[model samples]
Target chain A: MSARRGAGVALFVIPALLGACSEEERAAAAPAAPAAVASASGTLDLELRDSLEIGLELLEDGSLRARVRAPRGFAVAADGAELSGVGRLVELRESEGTLYTARFSGAPVGGGPCGAEPVSLALSLHRRGDNAFVAGSLTPYCGADRWHGRPARTPLRLTGELPALAAPR
Target chain B: MSPPHRAPLGLAGAALVASALASSPAAAQEKFALAVFHFNAQYVAGGTLGFTLLPDPELDLDDPTTEDRIVTESLDPVLELYERHPSWGVDIEMQAYLLDVLGERHPAVLDRLRRMAKSGQLDVVSFHYSDQLFIAYPEEDWLRSQALAAETFARWDVPLGRSVFCQEGQAGRGLAARMVTAGYRTLMWPKNLLSYQRSEFDTDPFPLYRLGDAWMVPGGRSMDVTAGSTNISVRWTFMDDGELLATNDMNPYFPELFRHDPASVAAYEAEVAALEADGYVVSTVDDYVTHLETRITPREAPPLLDGTWQPGSTRAVAKWLGGKGLWPEERDAHVRSLDAAARRELVAAETAATAAGLDARERLDSAWRLLFLAEVSDASGINPFRGEMEYGLAHATEALRIASDTLAEAREALGLAGLAVDPESDAVTLATGADPLRGAAVAEAPLAIEVHAGDRATDTSWELVATGHHRVAIRFGAGDERQLWVGFPGDAAAPLVTTLALADSTPVSFDRAGFDFEEFWMALPVGLLSVGTDRFVIKDQATAHLAARIERGSGDVVFEDQTAPIGETATWVFHVFEGSAVDAVALAGRVNSHRRIER
Candidate 1:
């Protein structure tokens, strides 16, 4: 399937994968990969819905890279765990000039964790003129057992904008 | 304004009285000893163990274990000492953070404190909401701290005393004016006499003097010796504290010290009893000030100097201001940037909220609280822990995020453009009618660029990256050891005015001062060289070590940015406009994109 078609397929498959089970249990279970994850190669300057700017790059190896450029102080996070400067994600899928979906798995940093299990983050970005609206959820799968029956899924709503690319100096 | 029937003691009479009191043991006994106990948890928000020699794993504001230990071990013994001596009035100076921690973790202890304060046995004094370096920040931040302290004290139903006490013992000439505006009547400064000698006080040791107007009194007579702008009458009394005596092996926080050493507690108790038995009135600072007002006359205060208690010099505060004491300059720079950005965003959020008519009281208060916590003095002061510095930066970043979110929502509600400028566009016209530079000049050519590495000058290059009607962006070449200096053609004799230098009422003239220089941070950003007809405002948005100097002989204002992280280009926006430098700074801030929401 084409990268665009694969991304569409992943969009339909994500909810079914999430299910009604708590995030910890689902996170403990292997993160289900889409039927065919799409990969597109290019760099796009994207702004979150709240006006946070991020530089997004899609690599040929089907990995996604997000870089925070402006607001020199901000740090990107995956599943509530702060990323060190740049965040790299796999199981990536993207539609040309339209949308993208990606998942990141990492051991949480800074905050206390019950276990060493890596949490999972599923994110989707829909591109518009100079803006990209995003929706995603972070699952504390690694430390799911420590939740003690508390909900572990954190929903994220981000509106992003893809401004006109700057001319090379 | 002189009171009737009160004799005005001239400078001679003050000196004579001081000499007589110094020689006479009987007169010395008549002097009142004001005892002020300073309590601090030494708490740094979001602090974690391992970075420093902290026994607790976390010193976070929300950590109950740390709060409980401080309340039970450090504070309870002190309160007990006060309780044992009901007739003794002592001043307790602390940050509102400790009070808040008491209210949350140990309410009973807080209640005891409230009762003591109600009965005037203990006077609760707060200089800031958090123990911040207020002089290092803008006056707005100082006001915010006062407001937050007021709110906290009101919530706890504790009396916030009229006297202000800086726990850090740092003071600037501008502090008295700010305190007067904040409704404070007295400043209990323990370090003043240390910075200024007895002779500086007209030979009267530890005399009560009215600040700003510079009046001092000796032996119940007032003398006005210097002129000041802050007409408001506020008094200052200097007392010797335990910290000062610690060099002589005296523990300042005796309650805490006595907790570990029982032998010392008995000795301290005996010393207190002896002091009372010797005809000395053990009084709080408030009572001492009241006594001074009623008994002693006012005299001309010595030159109000800027310093802290440590090092015992007027230049001591310079160590806290980008000096040697504030080490690891890179981390300090980053934290300073975060603090500046947070303050800017907070103002923007407030403005946006007002424009959108949003009732964002709770959210703004939270942001302000975080910002104040970020400004805590210990984070950047002498021997700061790495974890504490990062924690402070974290608070600043969180504050920025909260304020940015509020601003974004307000913009959305008001249907305003969120982006300050087109992110893609390098050039855009400003509505302020300020013209941008179309051409560039190198060192000693048309535009003078002076690059220095340590004491020697170095080679330099520059380019105009972007330009508009009101703004010009220049990117300077980077070198490993070079300090970048960019200058514009203007009158060297023109008055140089900086956002810092709060002591002087008039703009500093380079002609008079010869060479005037100041290191710029977000705390002190703008420097304008006004040439009567035209004004040149250098708005620094780069490193914290950016220094602006006005050379008397060269007839130019030079901006210096030290090389950091080596081989990184520094871009500065110079705005040439007709209006106030403040307006120019605001416009330049937009062009430089100072405000950004976090992702």
Candidate 2:
């Protein structure tokens, strides 16, 4: 479905960087195994209950691709923010070893968010060793919005369907 | 409360508890499982496979010559034999072995098995389609083989059970114990152990026993089967020790055991004679496997190993790849490569226009969708590539065009990434085979529809799904539906084909280890899509082209004939480069390249 919707866990969608080496690149990046998550920021904000962890593999080309797994929204922390307009954008930042950031918002489906005001929040990416984790939350305008049926330990492993990725194949 | 009232209440309570216990899901407790034989009457390897035994014992006395005769002789008769006799019971074993080989109870024997099972004599049957051995096949492919075979058999009026395995044939691979876990109980015939062991005074025709409920082959020497008994069919042994009915010269005595083995043969004969005196009656697999139990169930425990053995095949290797967990490093890297390929594809598509006015980009998108679906089905082992859907018609011509463009995009993308794109490759391959015969065969390998662009040019691409000599009906012009019987690789007696579609792209299906295409030239409806190194423009319906290279090694096909079209262009084309069997080699390596001391 939508790239923004997936496992509610912190998904580091930073483009993957390339370091040309012999098999050495693999050896170095080898230890950086893709794991679900290891840490959390704090208790999830009640408002960000259903926020998906939209994960992606950020390529060095600044192009992103997604492999998705839906989010299970039970154990993440979120702090609500005030919305400016219908197209309000929420900024996010992360630092496992390096800082990664993105801004997310809903589109005008039939119209816009159900409520007059939508909540947005800024997030920081965290990484312990080589593993990355998302630790922030955003609030959709509608109170009925939910991440998914189940809050998974790991966000949905999404492939293709990223915002920056090409339209559906 | 009165003592008498309490006692009555207690009794009722106990009864209620018993009922609950009965309904609770538990491993079935059975003494013997009836594993019948199951095979597709129309299984074709490389071309059309004749289910009937060829070189009829009465006529040719050898390999099947005519596909129809082989079907009639080997398959139809067995069912007819049972049908004529209302009292006889049938057991269908699984079909295995390549279509090219014969002489034993090979997969081609399914026609007879199905006919008999269809006649209402089937007692137990293997759930698998082609009798690919478990050792050689990946677990997922084995599951599909069983699923599609049993499901298809059911369509022919043969009731199918849910589980099966070549337990006896497997010496070390404990697939049967897992079969139980997978859900199957009564096996038609567990291999190995013979009928009637000769030890001193006690000459016992090894009675039917159970290894976790799966039945062993009918328990009696082929020579000892009592002609009057109908309880079990005492079969002769193969060179490898599997049992078979006596088709050779009779040896000695013991014809009387068949009557005493399972049921009285005299009773069966009387019923058969009675039926022939009348006409055909309706029957199926359900009646047989559940023949004994008063309470009938549609399924049983997993097939028991019971020490049966089938050959271990390597054809299932590709199927297994997707099932096992991939290292994160490998998976991510692969994804990266796939992305690059996809991007190049999009670019190539936009640059060109196909016959349908659909740009190369649009067709390429369709190709990618199909590949994605095939990759995700999770069939396991044998490169269990799966497909989501098979979009019907509309693309019949456009599909070929897309297939052509996609092939070039794949090569260009792969090459740019420094990936070695094989030298030989056709553009598009579409799915052009029937059921049982269907699946993601190389429908249209990478090939082009026409050499020159024109309205009269026949848009063509090729594919090779289930192998066999087939003549499927196809109309490649603008909106044509005149049905034709194109040849695919399937049994002429009974043909199975897959559906076609664009939105649901699952065209390129392959389980290398499965060797699904091991036979050729039967009454199968097949289509092929072709591609070339250079752009092709079609001028006429007849395209005179010659296939020079056909290799899986190159992941595409090779062909000759400069600008001239090859073969008769159809709705689809089947092309490829080159392919070779891959073998695993053991490697000797040091535990650590830096280590020197042995602690």
Candidate 3:
């Protein structure tokens, strides 16, 4: 997507704020990628100029789609999600690259969301044509932000004690 | 010809006056039909955990400064605050209802809003749930939040009929897709000043929003022989959906009295007067819907867009925070706070809802709603960061200053005044005497504030701001939307004004276009409302236009004394990157370059 002078909050997910805040001058879209997901929740500092976690919704065919995890929804970027067809949005929280899990309730766009109890499901991801997609057709069972390494990286399970790290600042 | 008919003329005039008053439009008074709807939700930016925050005040400490960190990544200070305060939801509404401070939760302080809606005193739109963080949660959470919000609104008499996030610049729109899915013909958001086609351009923080259908004229086409017609659902591809950035939300969101000084108040009122004069209506989301339905034809559409976050704003401030070399750990502390606060509220709201007769299903829905939208409110996460950094640690330790304060005085004042409520009260206090810090974080401080920058910070090509508290304004400018930060604090209860000092010239050219440079004074006293690192794009005019920084002016310049009410308070906070004093700063204001701005 095009990069503008954006800043504040998580610059990687919804890079739009930084683009909007850019006081320098206008320019074309810039190919900036989301940063790596930090496993430690106690203190992981980042900004607009930093990297962001790219969410992927893998498909049966092996193609990929991407989307930006905005403050509101999976704001679809030029990069689509890894999943295709009717896979649901899941929280792949994890701790230091340990047990990776997938939690899904419903697909993006249509249908109601997953039920309560942050469901946990086993899943994984792979890249395709510059895009990362989530792969799986599993039924969700939990709803909490199960994976906990970093709120940045997608398709992972949460594990660290992210009290203030994951709550509100 | 006058003596005999004088009585009749007086009667005729009286009748005319009465008729005019009668037809003055029921919206003239404080009619419920003319309400101001606002979405008070805490919104997270597009990034996730592990992302680095731009800059923070806490990092202005020792030798080396570190970069790339989240603003709310630490909680040691906040936890310490809890140890000091000990009472969380004591004198405020746990759910953040404004009335909580006045003590009304138990039986209900008669929930004036509910009363208003029931008694036809409001065209109000209630919240999705409690403390819902917008944009960060999963998609299902968004749906559950919407349904829960609808349910809550139903209980409050403000049904979740349409999507009404009439807050400053943030709202939980996880339901945007759902709303479209649910088939809302005319969804609305804040439409600041940008007016053009029926594109889904995000709205600025204007007081009101106008809605119209973008995809109209769906065809029920069959074999075009001779069959009649039938209505068919037609969803067209959204035309304008690239990136819309709008800025300049100072006056629209904050009240004039917020600044606790002078300059900011003047800027605020100038905008208000213009809006009032322009006949801009301060209607609620429902009314906005009605207006478009009535005024806008199927062929017409209002600027339609979502994504109510401004990036280009607070330029000077952001740079300032970004360059901190002092307290390196402050950034870490700040980011930790965000997460902690979110979790805190998450836990609190959930526990409370579950504790209060809410079923597992309802509790889940409400919890999701809180995370999805209500959490995005000032009563949620943003303000807590403000309490963390005071003008200087100026008073408390860097980590604890702005984040929390000593509430002994605040609680006493409120309690004595019969304004403070029990923490267990039905109200959810946003900024109260109990938790003076953390904004939505809730601390035991005497004063606290949260900024609702109106709709001025929505999608736009340029910057536009709503002049005052509750009005819409249009700005005629160029491209690359500027920045917008809400800082209005004082309202009609205490209006603010600005006074530009006349140069030490003779006779002082009365009402002249220009004057020599000397000093400018703007008054606002909302010290608590300041988001330290948030730089604002302040524009004020004067022929001599003073310097940029806002320090007390010691230089003596000539003055012109006139007999008009000059608004009290020069409470503007300017960012003078290089200037040593604000008295020496300059300006780029128009109309009121020297023209008196009154609110």
In candidate 3, what are the lDDT values of residues B494-553, reduced to their tens digit? 111122111111110111112121222221110111112211222221111111212122
Q: Rank the candidates by TM-score, best first.
A: 1, 3, 2
Output the better candidate (1/3) by DockQ.
1
In candidate 2, how many Å is residue B39 off? 6.6
Regions more than 4 Å wrong, model 1 = A1-169, B1-29, B42-45, B52-70, B190-206, B213-259, B302-307, B311-315, B324-330, B417-599
Per residue, candidate 1 scores C-alpha lDDT tens digits across A66-150 of 4322221111232222221112231101001123333333344334232334333333333321222222212122341121111
Tens digits of lDDT, candidate 1, B1-599: 22212222322223323533554443222344456656655443332333323333232222234344446654666677667877666677788877887886688999999998877777787878887766555456667777889888999999876666675665544566666665565665444333332334333344566766322223212223222211112122223332222222332122223223344445655676675565445556565555456444565454333345553332344333333342332234334444655676676577666657777877687778777877776656544544455445545644555555565566567665442312113221122322223235423232443444443334444334233223344444444644445565665455544343232222332232322222212123332344223354544332232333434344454554432324433444454444455544444344223322211
Stretches > 4 Å off in candidate 2: A1-169, B1-67, B94-119, B154-157, B161-173, B177-183, B188-599
**DockQ versus reference, model 2:** 0.01
- For lDDT, the strongest prediction is 1
- Who is ahead in lDDT, 2 or 3? 2
> Model 3: per-residue lDDT, tens digit, A14-97?
455556745443233443433322221121111222223334333333222222221222221112222211112211110001
Root-mean-square deviation (CA) per prediction = 12.2, 25.3, 28.1
The fraction of reference A/B contacts recovered in model 3 reads 0.00
Report the number of the highest-DockQ candidate.
Answer: 1
Instruction: Give lDDT tens digits, candidate 2, residues B1-599.
Output: 00111111122122323433443344322121122323332121111111123322233211122223333333344444455544434443434221212222334455555444444445334544443323321233344444444555554444443324342232211333444543554333322221111121124343332434342223212322221222222232121211112112211111211112112223434544453233212222233223222323222222221122221232112212211222111121112112122222222333322312343453354433322212221212222111000001111112222333343344344333212111112122221222221235245433322232233244333434333212121223422221211221212221121111110111122222222232211000011222222211111111111111222222232222211111212232222222211100000000000101100
